[model samples]
Target: MRWLCILFLAVLASGCTAAPGSNQTQGISQDKSQQGAGQATCAGYTFASAEREISVLAGPGNAIGNEHYQRLAQALDCLAKTVDAAKISSVRQQLDRLNPDVKSVSFSAVQREIEALYNAGNTIGPEHYAKLDSQLASLGQAGYDISALRQQLETVRPLAEKTATADNPAALKDLAAINKLPECNGQMLSDPPADLGDVQEISPLGNIGVPGHTLPTPHLYFHISAGRATTNTVPLLAPGNVTITSVTSSFDELGKIDEYSIGFALCKDVYGYFNHVKGLSAGLQQALDTVPCADFTDNPGNRCAKDLFYPVNAGTEIGRVGHLQGNF
Candidate 1:
């Protein structure tokens, strides 16, 4: 969308706020003695320079593309290596406990209940329960076994309450219900631009400010439909040797969100936030190794959770978006 162009231009023209310890290497100079001795002097990266490079690679007629990805990989690889396998395992286990993937079956069942409730002429309160009971009996009498349906309704009761009254019907259908769970941490991104077999219509208002409103701080939308699709929770490799700050999941079922505006932090700002990553594609992994590493020891305080690690599963049949939070 043209908005993407506008957003990028705005970001380029007005650089984001710098994070603490962001410019640790600003005045750092390579000792000429080291050069004479053939020792390598480490240099740090800057968001402005990265943006400038992206703008140039974008060219006058195009937005950032493959070259940009290469640059991004190199940038991430440049960050310091703060975490090891143990740290990665810890982060992965924590994320697993949250289990952000919405159960499609549960979401679909709740959607049906909402529709049936609406059709049954009940809004909320005891009347709704009564109607549900009646429907359950009818199903049982028809040999359909209402027990499973009843359990599903019980599981989705809280969600149904919000969806029934939400102003944005399409946007709230499934997400409204799932966002309340402890796992989502009150940070559900947004409905997939496409229906996950729940959201009904796609009007202008529903799409406006959609995923943008749901974005948290310091995240990037790493849309990866063009990349390989797998059925597992794969590693979203560190662009550099940064630490593992925090890992989160995006609820874009079917990857229909395509692209959206998101708050972003420069790699420098997020440097050292996450540990070194594994399981990247062969090309990306190789690219990461070739990139110079950033020394974050000078910027320890600057390390924080400002990036979102979004990985899309091929089994979900959805395109993907990675939300990288900018330090700003």
Candidate 2:
């Protein structure tokens, strides 16, 4: 509570974004040859420079009141709302006060100031608090003290029920149990099966360097192969070329341990070229578009059964030319 109040007060006082000006474009004329480039350059310079030039219009001696001055005024709207989450989950809650809202803010420096409020105050407005809760909830029930969490929620619920930032407790618990498994850290949680392939569990204490859990939030997406899986058997991919880029799930690293591992490989990294991605007779391409990865058991490989596999519903074909965007 103390930290939250401190962070919120800091945001209220900081002189941050540009003053509220017409977002509507101003007229600009240029030679046909330089038109596009000129506009881009102008937009960059004017937008960037005009920001600090604007005002916060503090009500008190040094305090600013304008929303435009603080990060909350300039955060980018999340356009990824429609992007297929598939194996991944996201919370719409407020972020740590130290973090930045890179999604909406043009200036990374400004955005960071906004993120400082991540877990700061849960009582300000429900929108911010709700997003924070939803994110933590997705961490799964492995190490969370549900009762304690609920107690905190009870306090928050009454004041901000109208603005939910967290997900339903029952939903979070169900997801955790579905993927529950013992690991070095504790229980490894799973992503409920998705239209795109879902992970059974992120292996704990995989190798010397690997951590006990895998979280998609930090972009560490991985999955362990359920059993023997391949393009032919799993119908997840057609055969062109296969190579693991990064593995998020782990069990053992030194010797071959096929039971728990998740590896990532972009289509562009696999096959040397792009096409309709007819490789997986199934919707694996579509799944790849969502997560584009498989569970890794060890450095050698992991098990993936046909049923456990989830292909991307829409994705691009891989090729030497690099990412050619399309959906199969």
lDDT of each: 0.31, 0.27
The residue ranges of model 2 lying beyond 4 angstroms of the native Cα positions read 1-33, 40-125, 137-151, 159-328
Candidate 2, 1-328: lDDT as tens digits: 9999999988877646334452322222224323432232322232223222322222122322334334322422221222223211221122222133222222233223223221111122355445445534543234443333333332223222421224544223222322332233321212221124433444232212212111111212223233233221112231222332211222122223311111222232121111111123223334435552222122222322111222222222221110111111
State each model's C-alpha RMSD to the native: 33.4, 27.0
TM-score (C-alpha, index-matched) for candidate 1 = 0.17
Q: TM-score per candidate, in order? A: 0.17, 0.16
Please give the TM-score that candidate 2 achieves against the real structure: 0.16
Candidate 2 local Cα displacement, residue 33, angstroms: 4.6
lDDT of 1 by residue, 1-328 (tens): 9999999999987666454456633323324332322322113334334334444543443323344354443543342132233433433333233222211123345447644432221223444554565556555665664544553333223323423446534324223323332342233222232223422222231222222222121222223222234222232332322222222111222332211111111222222112111123444334334433221112211211112323222222221222221100
